[model samples]
Target: MKFISWNVNGLRACLKKGFLDFYQEQKPDFCCLQETKMEQGQADIDLGEGMLEYWNSAEKKGYSGTAVFTPHQPLSVRYGMGKEEHDHEGRLITLEYEKFYLVCCYTPNSQNELKRLDYRMEWEDALREYLMELDKTKPVIYCGDLNVAHREIDLKNPKTNRMNAGFTDQEREKMTTLLSSGFTDTFRFLYPDLEGVYSWWSYRFSARKNNAGWRIDYFIISDRLQNAIKRAEILTQVEGSDHCPVLLELDI
Candidate 1:
């Protein structure tokens, strides 16, 4: 089955820019969306028939949010990690299928001034614990805007972006910790030698035009699911948001 993930920046705006067209073109078995920046009742999106849509909207309208669209119904669905404060932002949504758990998350950003770095670290710890607990029960297929460029190969100019929020040492280390705990970065597994491949780009400084971008969005699966991953891709040509779509195809 094919699974896809993308941070649409804003669902409303993205729709106008051909979100539906891309969705129809890909026709993935499952699709996870992050940074929707919309709340229930604010806008209506028709995804057509035969697809189940689940949304977790932040309490703050037009902020952080996530949604999952699946052709196969999940056995159960969960929102967040049961943390009252963290749940407010609608950062996480997990769909428990018979075989594996699919988690879509919009990780908290450290912001431009680095004022939220402490909180971001706390989130990292909590999220890691949550994923580990879930992994104990079943293998996981996690995706979305993880908001960190894991290594020097993940971004165009890692040296210049070292102190940046998404490239900070602390943030990257958290990603390392997650990967060390039996999760595989699917894209890297497929294209270890590929360069200048990125999923997200800045609107400022003509970043995308110059191919200055970061591979922040990801499709990470448990180590046990590594062999199941048939293909992993970054659809850089698909435009609508600052971030592009990441695709993963699994035999299961």
Candidate 2:
């Protein structure tokens, strides 16, 4: 199966900037989007005749949201981690398939000056527990904009970005804990030493033009799916939002 995850920043705005063109070209088995910032029916999105869309839009309009588009119908669909505190953001969606569970999430950002670090930490713990429980039932394909640079090699200016929102030790360690607990970061698993490639860039200071960006988006699978990984790539050339698409191909 071919899976694609991207943080469109804002789906409505992205549609105006060739989002449909790129979607048509890839035609992935599963397309997951983060930060959609809009509700279902707010846009005229027609990926194709049979493609089904499952959207989790924030109660607050024009804010954090997620959506999944696929031709396959899931056996069951779940919104959120079943935690009241975390369920309000529309940041998570789980689709239970015959063989695996597909989870798309937009992790909470720590925010400037670590204003939300406490909440972010709470979210990480809840998410980890949620994923672990799902893994017990079947292998999982979890993909989305996790919003943290796991290692120094994941960003251009690691030293300067050390304590920033996405690069803080607290955030990075949470990612480390996730990977250590039976999940595999597919891209790093495929190309351990690969560098200079990223999925997200800031609009300021010519970040994208200078290739100064961070690999915050990811396709993390249950450790059992490691052997099924066929292709993992960061589609740097694709443009629409600040983030480019990340692709993962599995032989399952």
Candidate 3:
């Protein structure tokens, strides 16, 4: 099965930039999106027949949100981690299939001045606990903008970005903690030493032109699903948003 994840920045803007054409061309079995930045009924998007579309929109308009599009119907679907406070932003959506659970997440960013670092850390803890609980029932396929460059190799200039939101030590450590709990970073599993490949780039400074970006978006699966990962890819060339698509082909 082919699975893909992307942080579209804004679904409305992405669609205007040929998102539908790109979606049709790729034809993934399942797709997850983060940072939709839209509210319920704000815009209507026709995904066509045979595709199931599910969205969790934030209460705050044009803010954090996530969505999932799948060819197969899930046995069950859930929004958020069952926490009232965290559920409001619509940052997570979980779909349970026969074999596994697919979790689409848009992790909270620490912000430019690290003002939200404390809250981001809290989110990490809660998210870790949620994933662990789900894993006990079945293998999990979690993907989307994790908002952290786990290692130096994940960003073009890690040294200079150390203090930045996504590359900060606190954020990186949280990712470490997540992976330590029996989850495999799929891209790293396939390309252990690959460099300069990134999924998200800044809109400022012509970052994409210079290929200066961060591999913050990812497809992370439970340890048990590691052997099922046929191929993991970063589709840096295909773009409608600031971030490009990351693909994972699994033999499920």
Q: What lDDT score belongs to each candidate, Candidate 1 first?
A: 0.93, 0.96, 0.92
lDDT for predicted candidate 2 compared with the true structure: 0.96
Q: Which stretches of candidate 2 lie over 4 Å from their true place?
A: none
lDDT of 1 by residue, 1-252 (tens): 999999999999999999999999889999999999987556767777887988999988889999998889899999999987688999999999989999999999999978889999999999888999999999999999999999999999998889799999999999999999989999999998799999999999999999999999999999999889898999999999999999999999
lDDT of 2 by residue, 1-252 (tens): 999999999999999999999999999999999999999999998798999999999988899999999999999999999989999889999999999999999999989889999999999999999999999999999999999999999999999999999999999999999999999999999989899999999999999999999999999999999999999999999999999999999999
Candidate 3 C-alpha lDDT tens digits along 37-71: 98646777767898888899998889989999888
Pairs that clash in candidate 3: none
- Kindly report which residue stretches of model 1 are placed more than 4 angstroms away from their true locations once superposed: none
Write down the TM-score for model 1: 0.98
Give TM-scores for every candidate, taking all chains together and pairing residue i with residue i: 0.98, 0.99, 0.97
TM-score of model 2 vs. true structure: 0.99
Q: Measured by C-alpha RMSD in angstroms, how accurate is candidate 1?
A: 1.0
Locate the minimum summed-lDDT window of 10 residues in model 1. 39-48
